[model samples]
Target: MKSSHILLLLSLASTGAAAFELGAPKNNNTDNLVWTGHLSPDTDSVTSALIAAHIYGGTAVVPEGINPESQFVLDYCQIAAPKPLNDFSQKAVGLVDFNQKTQLHPTIDESSIVAIVDHHAIGGAPVNMTQVTPIDIRAWGSAATILADRAESLDIDLPAHLACTTLAGILSDTVVFQSSTTTEYDRYYAKELAKEAGIVDLKAFGQKMLEAKSDLSHISAAEILTMDYKNFSYGGKKVGIGVAETLTAQQLLDRRNEFVAAMISYKETQKLDHLFFAVIDTKNKRANLLWIDDIDAAIAAKAFTGQPKQGWLVLDGVTSRKRQIGPAIQGAIEGKK
Candidate 1:
């Protein structure tokens, strides 16, 4: 065979032999590499998987929460790991470690990021393909479902403990698959993962997770603000914002005051060009946009005008930021003189 033909045949064979295995680590040559953090799903699952991978020879680091102020509780609240939570806590945990000064793309290059399965909208394009093993980011439901799907796809034997952790992440993100983001795939994976985790009743598991997240009695306004905070640049300016809403209209109504105060405080602290919060009534398909500092800027030349009554601007059929708020805000920013 010609040299070019030989190369082409080898390439074809490799492509044909490429199998789809979810949770298995790629490139098993572990000579100089120390760790691989499987970022996606909940911090707890990523932490658990990392610890396991570390046991065999590798360290693991997961992305911190939107605003990870508190110390990470690896095995707290019934989470499981290779070692006791106390032991994991005692050892120095690795962090993804991206700050304002550090360029986000190059940071992942320092270590072998084995797997990246995320549910959030991809923040920015990343560089470094040398060790880019597997990346799965689904906009539907939860990152947890993606992780579960990976385990199934790879035919990896998921332990009961990991299954429960995956189930909690799914329930938390999907709000028991009641959120508009939930899809058939999410439900399918949830059922499959629950079974693997030895959860007899997936619905009950979901309910319990929801209950645990809903226990907001102890959470302060600042904690709630940080929990869902995000920053994005638009119209030649950076905007820092936070979103807080209840799944039910009644819950939103009950916490209206707290949510309002939190938005105002967050706006002042962040010093953003424009600060806003959307109190989404998911069941009603409505959103109450709370304008903290820039009501005028938001509605300057736009069709919507006038101060929102009680800091609540009713938006019919506009609950999602990706579908509605993000586009609207971009348009407003672009249209500005």
Candidate 2:
């Protein structure tokens, strides 16, 4: 609860995000359910939606652009990222990876969000819980965990590739069981999923999957900026954070200027008050927090208690944004306020 952090948070508190609303007026797509994940969906988002679509018969809406690892996963599974969500004529909607209205597609009616499967903090409930036949939202390691569990409980037979992809989602979100948010249920389900998916060596396949997720070659700086990015309503302030899960932190540092410029442009374009881009070294289990302004660097320094070098905050053992970066930043903001 540093005074500077409090003052900083309070100064920007008035510019809060829209109030949380639960129900949207009923919409046209009540009979045809369309499912989607948050913007810039990663493995968990993509896989969870795939499973949901398979079981429930909804079209899985892909985000605007797909990342390399996500592309790799989709290709490996012999599937394609569903076409972008342009037409919203479907009757019902299901959200994955996130629950906030702001995180959904622009044209998607909140009333149409009849179901959801998410692992993040509950934003507003997009749909009335009582009205939705099945709503799965929990603070687990990954949304993949919830959906995979559901498939098993219901005795729904998932295709082999789908199982593998679901397992990939679990490994990615949990950082192969290294993240703090991981629970026993995550481990239990992961083991079951790995077996179901016909993965012989967990270590080998997990490493291969992680490697694929870390590949960012041939992608532009601007595209990289939004890769696995998410925005949060922190006490009314719009806080945006992005992550690059590369094999090594050095891979991003090599293009620091490009990354920084992209982030700055993205922040201004998105009208975000605060933005942070974390470069994760999955190989070494370390990270570097990059930001444009001094306040952001200072916040990262305090949040991770890491050393600030130039404009980047070097963290010794930081990886999971959900478990580490998100809470630390939120705490710094709230504690100071």
Candidate 3:
């Protein structure tokens, strides 16, 4: 490890961020480094990996298939999608968007993680990676925003494709700045990136991306449930939260029975104690929360303070799962004790 990396590790460790070492040594060869994001990656995760690899010297890879919005951004910007990476045996890895053990692939060598630029809480992260490497985890709305800001500060040139995708990432994660997670930095960078990408009408471009994200016409119920899902540990219980953003919420709500059945099967297969799915209407900025059974309905009622209507909880002005739903659910679970 470099002396600077050692100093950074020591500083992070003093803040109680260090955990047990996963026994992987630090690799200094930047050429061999690879950047990736969480499973079921959304637009921000996908774009952040590309941007990170561009600014840093490495290849960008995806843990799984890119979501629709991400694909739309890549195609629109004329950027090719990164290849998928299944094995992390000898690779020096950097993570974007998420920092959790549960979100990682089972085959990941925890010790090989040299960097993490994420906008989420550090849950079960192998913090000991800090002892041998540098990591960037902050409260920004999107990991893409973090990387974009870094590139800007360091005077790193962001090409047109990267700038466009970075802007798309910010829009997707912040829901066009409607999400509560949106910060001033996110807003500022979005505008700057828009100009750099030659997007004269930012809102129009964001609408296009959202429409692309809403096009789930040919996907199955099980695929929808896993599309933008995440695993969280709340109140000593394993919980799974899935969000499906669409322009036409009614179209998806019509398939409530199918989604419910799929949710139940997914819950059982993952052995999760609780599972919740929120179908978000981006236009109206609301969500139709679906429950699989009585237990899930009870939990939703407590978390959202809303009664179920025809087996769905109507959450008005609830778009951001990270900002609104997940925190509410976690609070409700903790409050029960």
For lDDT, the strongest prediction is 3
Model 1 spans with C-alpha error above 4 angstroms: 1-26, 29-77, 81-115, 123-134, 245-265, 282-285, 295-309, 316-319, 322-324, 335-337
Q: How close is candidate 2 to the true structure, as a TM-score?
A: 0.84
lDDT of 1 at 32: 36
Query: Alpha carbon lDDT of residue 243, candidate 1?
Result: 53
Clashing pairs in 1: 21-154, 22-154, 35-59
Q: What ranking of all candidate models by lDDT puts the best one first? A: 3, 2, 1
The digit string of per-residue lDDT tens for model 1 on 257-319 reads 887687677677766676666665655667776654446344432623334545477777665
Candidate 2 clashing pairs, residues 3+ apart or interchain? 6-336, 6-337, 16-236, 29-90, 29-91, 29-92, 30-91
**Residue 21 CA displacement from its true place in model 3, Å:** 19
Per-residue lDDT for 292 in model 2?
90
For each candidate, give its TM-score against the true structure.
0.64, 0.84, 0.89
lDDT of 2 by residue, 1-337 (tens): 1011010011112223222111221222334766678878788888888887776666777756666777777776677676677656554677778876556667776555556677776542333332333345666789888877767655688888888888888887888887778877678778877787788776677687778776676778788778888887766778888888877567677788998889888888999878998888887877788889876766665666787665577887888887788888877655652
Worst 10 residues of 3 by lDDT: 1-10
Question: What does the lDDT read for residue 194 in candidate 3?
Answer: 96
Instruction: For residues 1-337, write the lDDT of model 3, one tens digit per residue.
Output: 0011111222343334333221222223564678898889899989999998887768999989988788889999999999998887778788888877768876678776767778886542333443345666667679888888778755789999899999999999998888878888888889999999999999999999989989897889899999999888777788899999999888888888999899889999999988999899888988889878778766777788665667788888888877789888887777841
List where candidate 3 sits over 4 angstroms from the true fold. 1-28, 123-130
